[model samples]
Target: MSDARPAREPGRRRLVLWRHGQTSWNVERRFQGKTDIPLDETGVAQAERAARLLAGLRPTALLASPLRRAADTAQALADITGLPVRYDRDLIERDGGAWEGLTSREIRERYPAEHAAWQPPGGETSAQVAKRVGSALERALDELAPTGQLVVASHGAALRLGMSHILGLPEETWERLGGLSNCCWSVITEMRDGGWRLAEHNAGTLPEPVLSDDRPDAGT
Candidate 1:
């Protein structure tokens, strides 16, 4: 398929938060944290396929976590779009600390209370992650044109938490935002009020406008 820029409304910008492809830890259900595990063979293929689809969206900027898995995934798109991929430390995954390399069941068995609270001992908290990643995203946006489309290759928890931070979702309701599957992505559009609206989540295909009662002109 021909790769061409997609049409966008004037004065609006789009951010695509894309999760990296699968790794060995992903298949084993082990915590990756900042482990820097490279992508598995399957992951390489996944990134290639995803890159093809995202290339059609014609992203203007690319950013990614410096972690190997995320960086490699971003490279796939960069190779296609010829956009330089910028690495941001703030985009790294939540530091799992003592929980790193442990499976979910193992974590619960070893640290019952911490696991119950979803807090890894000596690791970054969800709030901290949200703030760090969110700030990075805002800074990147500041450098982008109003109509530019930016694609960020990052980890699942980081992207989810960051998106929640930007969208101003309360911590209690953060879980309401589901995790993205490997190589999937979510899109957020800038609203006229300088806020953001989630247009799509955990999507593998290009976004289409959805009819909703919440539309700005719905009551007219």
Candidate 2:
């Protein structure tokens, strides 16, 4: 008799939206925008730790922004999972143009109007970011198996905007979605109706914690 288990229907695929680790500019509350800032010591450590957890999830594909911060973050996962990271410019942070590197207070003081509107002088609109990121994510999803998962390492704004688009949220309501903390991630899963759903947002853990101290040994 054949010992093979019966074939099962394809399961929902997952897309993990991850924000890159913190940078010096982030600590200073500066607008990193499209600037390529390398991660600080703490940022590196964060990436490594998050990678260890995410690797256990068996992500089948890794994708990242070409910017140094995001690339480095994704590299950590690549190191653990032995998966190659595909860089996409569409995953880069929103273009801040003249606002890049400017601290939040400085931007407000120098250009109150633009600050209120949250638009940089020559920067990209949120709509533009959402479109590009959404397109890239769609392409990545096509490459993933129905039961497989993909991890996308990118900027806070970029990932949030992309996720909003994927969920078909209205442009005016995109602001309702909060940004992800450094190294934190969101999970999106395909629903049975073929629509995407936000299963988890800003989840910082892989093996979710339980309430009691009766937890078994990790290796168990």
Candidate 2 overall lDDT versus native: 0.82
Q: Tens digits of per-residue lDDT for model 2 on 55-81?
A: 988999999999999999999999999
Alpha-carbon TM-score of each model against the true structure: 0.88, 0.88
Evaluated at residue 219, the lDDT of candidate 2 is 12
Clashing pairs in 2: none
Model 1: CA > 4 A from native = 1-10, 205-220
Alpha-carbon lDDT of model 1? 0.84
Candidate 1 on 97-184: residue-level lDDT in tens? 9988887679879998887677889898989999999989988887878899999999988898899998999988887777777888
Model 2 regions more than 4 Å off? 1-11, 205-220
